[model samples]
Target: MTRRPVPEYAPDRLTAYEVPLRTGDALRTPHDIAAILRTVHTGTHIYLRDKVGTVMGTTLFTGDPATVTPAPFTNDDWSLTLLRCLASPSTEELPEARLCGFLFLAPDRLRLYLATEEAPSGMTAAGVRPGGALTALLAALPALLDEQRLTTTDADDPHCARVVDLTDW
Candidate 1:
């Protein structure tokens, strides 16, 4: 069943981040989240470990951005968006997951949304991390673009905020 779109943000509390990303090519086949997991996820994990701290799993989204109503912003087309939560700082110690982020690639740009609910605290901390997904995405982008993965035209970053943005519709 198609998951109904859920409200990811509240008007009273608005928080968003514009991840400055240097775009490359696409990362995987459009809408093929499974394929991305097989090829990019595992490899990207290493980079995330070195850059953004650590992540346990991810959620994927595909289709018209309009389907996601009341969005912070919109894009013409969007495919294979990935969302993951930043887990504990170290594997040895367990703590509440503080931050979460979303990643999506358009034909010409890469957009990242780090939820603001939990202030900027963790491995990657704040702003953009060099060795984080940014680095791994650079390597993975071309592969997706080469495959002509799905993308949007005249796309604008949504600047998503809230755990729902990373975990729900």
Candidate 2:
């Protein structure tokens, strides 16, 4: 994957929210984001860009989410696609949801731009099919954000918190 300089997010724009650890589970913390990310197969990475177009850093998730493997993109490939979507005319009804970005961790470098009129709509990536582990995580994520109040201060675990708070969308 080609590495490029990621722009810094404005302090006012950076915000945090919570997502579910599991269905009906109430243990909400940014730390759990890594566990959710680990659901993806090895060599998979998720890029969550915000509405204002800010990318932070990359987290390498190296665990077995499922037996299947997803296709990998050559770094800039997915970024280019996301740029196209953002540049589209506002009048045009884009498939993108209000607070979402591209998801390109699927097999065969399968790229999908996940936008939701509301979040938790979720999308499939890599070999992680619609009902796969990744899909479940995405579906479960939005609800947690809606149900729980976010912590005002940064969590002690800065690394994992970075992954969870990566998106401003």
The estimated TM-scores of all candidates read 0.18, 0.19
Q: Where does model 2 exceed 4 Å of error?
A: 1-79, 86-99, 103-110, 116-169
Q: Candidate 1, which segments miss by more than 4 Å at Cα?
A: 1-99, 107-109, 115-169
Estimate, for each residue in 1-169, the C-alpha lDDT of model 1 and write its tens digit.
8997655553323322122222246442333333333333233222322223212222222222222122221232222222222322335643233334434343423344333323343221122222324334433432332222242232233343211111111
The global C-alpha lDDT for each of the candidates, from Candidate 1 onward, is: 0.30, 0.35
* Candidate 1: C-alpha RMSD after superposition: 21.8
Best by TM-score: 2
Clash pairs, candidate 1, are 25-141, 26-141, 26-144, 26-145, 27-144
- Write candidate 2's Cα lDDT for 82-123 as tens digits: 334344534556533333344444432322333444444343
In model 1, which range of ten residues has the least summed lDDT? 160-169
